[model samples]
Target: MSTPTQKHTKSRKNIRRGAIRLKKISLANCPKCKKPVKPHTACAFCGSYKGKVVKKVRVPKSLRKSKKQEKSKK
Candidate 1:
């Protein structure tokens, strides 16, 4: 029969297992509020996606503009 080679500690075991953490998701900017919003998801604050407003969004006219304006100019 084979005997045990060595023992492992809790801290060493944890380090060997690697850090257990949640993957961060990439968030998109809200068109209406210019706030960070998850992609293909409704805004948590205003609850809006695409053009159709899913929730009430208070957007200022000045902030609203063509994001591709620079590309179009060229």
Candidate 2:
């Protein structure tokens, strides 16, 4: 295999890697639940998509905290 004859400059390297850098995740609000969600995907909190119910999600008992518990914590 042949190797590069010349050293790549930092500016050139950076320019080439510019597109490889991490990008911010674009998010859209769920119309039903008003939660941040990825575009074209169902809202995980309410299981909704495009103003319609596409999935039925059941909240587990362990994850559900009562109002009384919240008040006691504070």
Best candidate per lDDT, number?
2
lDDT of 2: 0.89
lDDT of 1 by residue, 1-74 (tens): 99869988888999977877778999889898789988998887676779567776666555555545755787
Candidate no. 1 TM-score: 0.45
Which one is best on TM-score? 2
lDDT of 2 at 38: 96
> For each candidate, what is the lDDT?
0.78, 0.89
Which ten residues in a row are the worst by lDDT in model 2? Answer: 60-69
Tens digit of per-residue lDDT, candidate 2, span 1-74: 99999999999999999889788999999999889999999999999898989999988776666755887899
lDDT score for candidate 1 against the true structure: 0.78
Local lDDT at 62 for model 1 = 57
